[model samples]
Target: MKLVKSLVAVAITVSMFSCGNQVKEVKTLNTEIDSVSYAIGLNMATQFKANLKEVNDDAFIQGYISGKDSTNLLVAQKDIQTIINTYLRKQQTAKMEEQRAKAAKEAEAKFGDNKKAGEDFLVENKTKEGVITTDSGLQYIILKEGTGDQPASPSTRVKVHYHGTNLEGEVFDSSVDRGTPAEFVLNEVIKGWTEGLQLMKEGAKYKFFIPQEMAYGAQQRGDKIKPFSTLVFEVELLEVLD
Candidate 1:
């Protein structure tokens, strides 16, 4: 409907431009009605120039005259709005896709190195003793083994203390530092935590080397956790609450 209004404004400008020769004959706008009409015409012309670049002036003026006279309309009045709305929707979709593509390119340029560093770190770390790499690219080492039962499913809620850090060992978050155990359903966490925690029994402590794809991926969490970052965490399984 907004686009329709803009098109109407453009059409008014086109109508005035088309009738420029006839308007020149009436030079003086002495009456208030005449002055107001001229001023609105000027405003419409300015709006058309600012809002639209490409318009068929001849067809627009012809359509305007036909519409005003209520005769010889090429399109039915009911169908005109539908056609215009469809065109406007397509334009909006194309513009949104263009913006997303531009944003993706910019993100890759900034975070490409972080992705490469994670890949390199994983390649070297996988060869170390006690470090186990899974099919999903999650790596971890059992720090303290437990004998209790493992969680039954990803939906099971569990309590645990964890110290999380970036690749540079800069701590980003920690329930351990706050002196409280965090608790949630395993499915609600990152892919790495969900998968890795399932491998542990109650009272188990594990150090995880989570790849970016299994962690936050391209999302920047805070000032400390940049986009495409691999995360490290020391997790202790306190209790399986359900």
Candidate 2:
């Protein structure tokens, strides 16, 4: 109900602006009522200017006048609500797409080479004797195989020590360096961790070569890892806390 009233106010303001020259302007606000009315109009005009470029001013004014007088209404109230909702949702989607496109352009200009570097490294890494590549492009080498049981499912919590690095082997994060094991539900982490951890048993150590898509993809994480980076991690599954 509030949104409907707001849209009506915006439509009225847009219509008034479109037909401003035809309407006689009142120079003097002699009465309190006249001053308040002028203030309200000014406020609405400022608020209405946003996202109103596509509005049809003439049609809006006709509808506004007709609805106010409760006469000759062309659209049902429920239909009007649906129309407004759909239009607003489409506008929001368009704005988000524009933003994403702009960001992709910027990322390509900056870290475009990073993606190529990761792809080249992965191609060679998969052919190594100990390295195993999964269908999803996740590559790993078992440093130590554990005899204990693996995590029951992706939802299970586990404690582990890890050393994380980019394709260049520059260390980014390490539970080993911090001297504390990290704990989390496997599904809550990145795709690489979620899938790789499930393959390991308790007390097993594996070195994962996670492709960009399984990692952050186009997202920048801190200063070391750029967009489309292939991440390397030495993970030791200490315990699977069901």
Candidate 3:
């Protein structure tokens, strides 16, 4: 009965496609495809367009058209290759650094209040009941106790649920939000997790306060996380996978 309903559903879907929008483009590629290529291409064009002016767009599109038509003779092939191999990397790097500086300046303007909040939070948090601070500056409070065997080494793989945030309590990442458990080698994570998990057993839950050095340090991860950012995590060890 389920199979029949599924077949009917498929038929209805097919009929909807057949009766509604008929794409006039020829299927020269044989395998099923859609306007995704055009959509993606248009999206990319808009993104680039946002960073450029009409004159720049005209120049780029005309140059591309020229390339497609094999009409280029103005610039030497070697010069074009040199532009790509030599100057492009430097230009891209400069642009990225400029963007990073801009982001840092903006972060100072936005979450500056919480910039020192983590340090203060940790200072008081460490004094709380059952809160243990390791010599290396990792602080954790046991949320749930486990009777299962504790991981013997950093090489052990474990499954866990975690929610990570910066000093300002802005969430950086969360397996809980994704509604999925994370499985990873114990040592493969940040130093804080590597050391903190060693004190845990299967079915154990702990809230960890990881200092900036133990986390991403002075380096940035993507855009949201900034340099020298302290992190807080609520980690639950679900299983010792290996």
Question: Candidate 1, TM-score vs. the true structure?
Answer: 0.60
* Alpha carbon deviation, residue 137, candidate 1 (Å): 0.5
Candidate 2 collision pairs: none
Residues 1-242, model 1: lDDT tens digits: 65567556544342243344232334778777666657666675675554444567677666777776679999888898898778667766877789877865687799999889999999999999999999999999999998887999999999999999999999999999999999999999999999999999999999999999899877789998888899999999999999
Q: What CA RMSD would you report for each candidate?
A: 7.0, 5.1, 16.2
Clashing pairs in 1: none
Model 2 misplaced regions, further than 4 Å? 1-5, 8-49, 56-90, 146-155
Which stretches of model 1 miss by more than 4 angstroms?
1-104
Clashes of each: 0, 0, 0
Count: clashes, candidate 3: 0
lDDT of each: 0.83, 0.83, 0.70
- Model 3: which ten-residue window has the lowest total lDDT? 7-16
Clashing pairs in 3: none
Error of 3 at 55 (Å): 52
State the lDDT at 165 in candidate 2: 95
Model 3: residues >4 Å from true position, as ranges? 1-117
